[model samples]
Target chain A: MKSKITRIIILLSYSFVNLYLIVTKKILKYVHPKIIPIIVISIIIMSIASMILILNIKIENHNKSKKNMYIIFIIPIAMILFIPFKQSECLNTNFTVTQNISIDNKEFESAGKQSISNNDVMNSKEIDINEVIENNKLDEKIKELILENDVIVVTDNNFVKWMDELYENKIYENKEIQITGFAYKESNFSKSEFVIARYIMVCCAAHMAVGGLMCNYMADDIQQDSWYNISGTIKYETYDGETLPIIKVNKAVETETPSVEYVYPY
Target chain B: MYKNKAKNTTLHNLTLIIITLSFGYLLGHLIVYIGFDQVSRTVKIFSTKFTSIIIEALPFLLIGSFISSLLHVFVPIDTLVKIFPENKFTGTLFAVVAGVFVPLCDCAIIPIAMRLIKKEVPVHIAITFMLAAPIVNPISIMSTLFAFSGKTNIAIIRVLFGIIISISVGFLFSLLVKNKEIINDKNYCSHCTINLNNTVWDKINELFLHTSEEFFNIGKYVITGIFISTIFQMMFDSIGLNNISISNNHALLLMLLFAFCISACSNSDAFIARGLMNSFPFGSIIGFLVFGPMLDLKNILVLNKYFKRHVLIIFTITLVLLTYTIVSIAFF
Candidate 1:
């Protein structure tokens, strides 16, 4: 059986952890900013509640089984402090990105159809890519970069949308591009092929999904989890019967992993 | 006798602290020796998801516990009974309306509902409040509106479906289960006597005492639910359901399953649903938005802990059928 003090300490410890997360600004990595104020209020209420519990500790409620359950609360604290904080790229092994690029004419359909189709559901509008780009009113620098055609850079902000555009329009036929990401190799892929991937985190590391373009390079020694800066040109490839955007590398150099590992969804 | 009890409690507490410290040391050594590389990535994903779920829900859990404390200590149970109308239909309707006003998250709703049920509120009404409050609230509405900005119909459909389904389920539960107490033996303490004439300080102390006790008791369930949900998410992610090609109906099933496992907050689920707008059908996306806030991995555990096994099962099955039917019919 545990005493009231033990219960109080457990509650206080949780409050302490929240305070720690709030102070360290690590809470943002796990939750949206909208919940931060709530977290702060929780800390205040929890700490006050803990103090009150301490002041009025009793000896009557000593159920051994219930006391044992309090141990579970310690897991979160242990996870945050003891576990080595690393990128969630561990999900690369099984994580799958949507690779099918079905340019449809029904872009203005009232509702999204299923990714697969048996009949005319798959048909979509063939909108002009250049006109769409012009209408988007992208930043002048990004516009210049995309038109550079020789060494276009794909940052986190424009990676997914840009890729989607290039895939839809098939404009990156032979345009050179430079991108930086960690290497991920699928089980079926050869040693010469890897995915240069980044996690686009919408909510937290747990909710992060993989976002990257496939790469075809000639480095058998490229290790998994190693970050690289690869200058490559676009190459269309059919892997496992699905056509996808593959970067044919011109130059590859090892680079330090970015401090902010995960990119937010644009 | 009192002195002996106090001494024994202190000794037991000390022993607990020692044991906890020892476990911590062993765990620390294990993590260091194995390192993250040796440890399976699946485990890290599980831990990361579990941690995020708990951290994300912690604030709401605290708020719910606090609200439960205030209700138990300050508010009288009979007052709740008085406010609820006599007709079961109106009562359920009242619950749905009231649910919209209180913008509690799923994590916050259970504790408050437990308190309500303890106060002799109708089981159906409490269930209505529990299921509806999370989705029908203002914050969720705003987020849904923002997420489906151009397509205002989706947001409206989400809110309307949330209310209709919740109220109908409340009626169904009302039919199956009577207005009896649904809280389990562990938490129901209505028989305990209270001294209303106690001083303000004593009342404050009593309030905090009950608050802390309830928090500790329920917090365990929250953590357990999160752990299980995280493992479920890891498995789901590993399966890579998104990669598969399926018909719209099958896609809805997969999405419903996904929503149950993911257990994202109602306020943020809109964003996730929006993200899926490109790949999944609109009906399935609606299913994701509607079904998740109402029933998910964590809240299932909470509901299981409080309600009878039969009642919980009935609620789950009923909610799933109703949500899927309404969404599919409306969209398809």
Candidate 2:
């Protein structure tokens, strides 16, 4: 009977977490907004399953291994309670505000240099943004900004497409661009260098990877995980023979957390 | 008894255990070398990743459990045994086709297959269904189509490669495993599978009870798989694994490595694979798409929960080699 109660409690706890996440909209932090419908259906099924489990409380069936199942499930539930409710807060409060030595270790970067050079053959070839944009239906506004705008301001929706266009086409070289994101510095980077990273959440946080342009701002006081807006011109940096964009910033200001935490492209 | 009961003390089992243990330790050291801890960014990332996977996978997992439980209570064993294909080739073909129609994700399919096997379905048919359903499903195909921006070739090629690989793997297994039960279903819990309720209410009760059992059992493995794979992905990312260069054949190998480690769901993996466009060539991208749903880190852990470790290891090796060969040939 005691074991039966524990099982019921565990099942209800599962439903409660789902409800809590949905009620608070914290589910958006972990997964895309599109998945909310699936989540709704899951909670309904679990809730029904729990009620059925309660009515059959006298079944007396679970063995020692059966009880152990509930024990293992407690790990995920407990860990979820500690997660920040908002996606933006997740970066601002929990993640790296400063460069962790492992990520930017000089030896590691140099070791990877050989492979980076291999891509120089591919990256060296010039890509025409105008032609590519006309052929491709994606990235309407941001893709057009390259030839028209004097200073392109990067927003959450166009962040990824803008990055791709800027990387390939030389039109953006030495052009002023304004961007805002969580500040992250690699250890191999000097004090003046850091990446303003934004997570590209395709479906959920599970598929997220750090993406941003490297910025060269001569300042000692940059918070690692906090959001910052930087005004800079796109410049090229060569590593082992392959060249990629690096921002040379004229104005670096610690900004309020961005309204949008992640860029949803797909 | 299950597959392992016959081969308890074999050198093969010992070697597999040692390999698994070392792989785990290697993962641990990688995190520690980077100074990971409770307060570290990696830990937070781990929590987020684990939670997201579970949350995303929950609906499919429950629906799978419900289907499995429904079969357990309502569908008689004799009926189940009757519907199974008589011939090996036809059975494998039928199972792959069933996967395309039913179209459950991997999370949902395992429990359903286990239920079928419990009802005396052929091991190969069930395993084939498990492998093929997630990959060839309409949702997965449509997602692939959308992710690749309606490149019919990418979606078509992926489904073609997936069907070929799983069918071959299934046909091979049917030759080896025959109709022997891979899972030990006897002398266990009195609550589910073995019981056949008469009254409608009693059957419904059995359904819910069995659903609970299947969910909890599968959830444990899912959690463990998520924990290991997420930590592995996070640790590698921290060390800048993706930033490294890939040259020629190495791209295919590395993409396979990424697919194994990353373990994204089949439904959404195309988007992730699409992101790999510039870094690796089309052949390697194809390898990642085909190889992932069949034999990834998460699926391996789930497969280990049922089959013998040696069986999984062998099948994994076979799947890897076949995918590499077929994809290389196709792209060549």
By DockQ, who's the top model here? 2
Name every residue pair that clashes in candidate 2: A97-A224, A97-A225, A98-A224, A104-A188
Per-candidate DockQ vs. reference: 0.23, 0.25
Interface RMSD of each: 7.0, 6.6
DockQ of 1: 0.23
Task: Work out how many backbone clashes candidate 1 has.
Answer: 6
> TM-score of the candidate numbered 1?
0.71
Interface Cα RMSD of candidate 1: 7.0
- What CAPRI class is candidate 2? acceptable
List candidate 2 stretches off by more than 4 Å: A62-66, A82-153, A165-178, A187-194, A214-223, A230-253, B1-43, B71-104, B117-125, B138-157, B187-200, B238-264, B267-285, B308-317, B328-332
Over B1-332, each residue of candidate 2 has an lDDT whose tens digit, in order, gives 45434443343355345446645755675566576543444456556777888788766788888888888888888797677678877887888888988756777787788777777887778878888888899878877765554245667779888988888777677666645546544322345535554788878777787787777767766766666666666655565443567675787888788788767788777766664554457778888898887777767766666665556666777778877888877664
Candidates in order have lDDT scores of 0.67, 0.68
* Model 1 DockQ class: incorrect
Which 10 successive residues of model 1 chain B have the least lDDT summed? B183-192
Over A199-262, each residue of candidate 2 has an lDDT whose tens digit, in order, gives 7665677765445777888887887878888888999777434566778999988888755577
